[model samples]
Target: MNATEKFYLPVDGIFDMFTSLTSPSAVTHPVVQSAVAPQQHPKAPSFSKTGMGIIRMVKESWRQPMAHRSSSSSTGRQLSIERQAKRSVDLLELGLAKPKNCHRIVVLGAARVGKTNILQRFLGNDFDESYAPTAEDFHRKLFHIGGDAYQVDLLDAASERNFPAKRRLSILTGDTFLLVFSLDDRESLHHVRDMLDEIAAAKAKLLKLKHPAKVPAVICGNKADLTSPGAVTRSEVTQALGKDVTYFETSAKDGTGLEGAFRALAALGGLPDETSPSRHQLISLLSYQTLCISQRGRGGLRARGHGAPCAAMDPLARRPSFTSDLRLLLKSGSNKNNKPEMCHVQ
Candidate 1:
């Protein structure tokens, strides 16, 4: 054995070799100092006493964003849903700050019939001539009629091609219906009858309102400027429909009857009663017809020799009616009977 190794005490074997991982100063013990390497000692603070500080440093690192810390709690680690909820609340507050008088008007008709054009004209927006099939569109406008303000929500819905259960809600919820058809297109006018029937059927099956015409629906004849001479006369519409229905003539190109149609619709809603007439209890559709027919024939429509009496005179089919702001603006034409047309009744 070497000379240094020969100097061993029996008591040295009492305890096994001792070193420290927690502190550098533990090497001050001569036994530990002799056994440990001096270069291997870390110069920083001892990790045992500084462990909390190291944990705090790790927490601070996570507090700041990876890119760059901007503000107190606006780091990327924030919950995304919490931020979205806050934004939604702010928007709701802004929306509720001021009251809005919103009216939903449904524009329904066949394609290429200017249903979109009338809405755009009312909105003062640009018109697109592209033939894109509409599957329910929405537009908004703020207008004033007779010193009162209103926000009209125009639902430019697709045609009957897509009127499944999902889309029929538009028909049920509309505040007013603008059934648009081109004045130049007589087939569109004929198609309107089918639409009305569909609406009536839908209402009958869905809503049990006092009036069948619960929604203030009006048939709008678009493309007035495109009509030839004597094309879409009020007489023609009345005869085709066989009964009076709310109607309007509009030209989206030159903007004719647009404002009036909207104004009339507002009146029809009976909100701004300033434009609508006073409460006129619905007298009778038959009464209006009898009034017209009796003026021509004396004594409750005099029997014209075994011919069936007028439909108005027949009490079986002739039923109840209600008063509305609905009125027909006839252009003064004679019917097949060579008599003056029926008077405009509201």
Candidate 2:
């Protein structure tokens, strides 16, 4: 017999029986039992009848391959459990990935028209009286609305007349423009026409090259805090620009009309609204306006005209530099050399 069968065999008679059973030529089987000793004489007759029979029955039951079957089943279950754990971790990483298609909105306006103040009011709920000019072309901010994240980049360039071409290109980067004008100054209001012309030119270049859709424009009449009985009216602005254009009278000083203005922008940018059930809701209504006047200023707003004329463009004029008015406002009380934030969200 093999080594395993030899270990199970009894010392004398068991070995002889196993050898005969394993032989291919053997046919007759022998059944035998050991003789009982004198100490076991009383039970010898009972042992021969039942005890030996029970021992043989137990050995026959264990001869089946029960242990080998159990070990194979346990190994298979362990492999399946390990594979499931790996798949769960991979799904979690994918869900945490950053969102794609984040929109960038750039704010453009003349200097000292409260563009930076408007941005600060939206980003941080505070305002500053004294702030410096913006040095970079863009500033970025993030918001979570309607279960989606949006990235807004507000661009306010130096309103000097030196580099018209560079400043024109900066205005082209925005998908939409918030053209800010001062209600207290007629000159600032008149500058909007020139601004629109430059914007249209930049858009035409994009169209010739088969670029994306043209950027939409919105006219904002700022300094509503200074609006008085004799100030320029919204009707006049519409007549000067067109009735088809979007308009808003906002007061950055008193935090008026800020929410509606931003919400309108979010809607125009194809951003989902928290209040809407649809996946993409277009901003259809634009009736939101602020008419509140500031108490700090005089009853009759005085008009402030141009103090410095725009410089002439040079052959070696430097490329236009755009700065975020928000960062400039944020750094008003601290460092002056901090780089303006410009990276896109997605």
Name the Cα RMSD for model 1.
24.8
Measured over all alpha carbons after superposition, the RMSD of each candidate to the real structure, in angstroms, is 24.8, 26.7
Error of 1 at 297 (Å): 66
- For residues 9-72, could you state the per-residue lDDT of candidate 2 as single tens digits? 4534453453443344533532222211224355444544464555566666666656456676
Q: lDDT for each of the candidates? A: 0.52, 0.51
Q: What residue runs in model 1 are displaced by over 4 Å at the alpha carbon?
A: 1-100, 126-131, 142-150, 209-211, 227-230, 270-346
- TM-score of candidate 1 on Cα atoms, chains taken together: 0.47
lDDT of 2 at 218: 67
* Residue 133, candidate 2: C-alpha displacement in angstroms: 2.2
Off by over 4 Å in 2: 1-100, 159-161, 209-215, 274-346
Worst 10 residues of 2 by lDDT: 284-293
Report the C-alpha lDDT of model 1 over 1-346, residue by residue, as the tens digit. Answer: 2447644423222122221335434545565445454546464336434654555565567567665746656554244433433321211122311233445677778778988777666554556767666643765433233223334456665653454643455555556778888787788888777777666655554443455544467778887777498468888888876556777787877777776676677666654532221211222333333233343344332222322211111112211111111111122223557664443221
Clashes of 2: 4
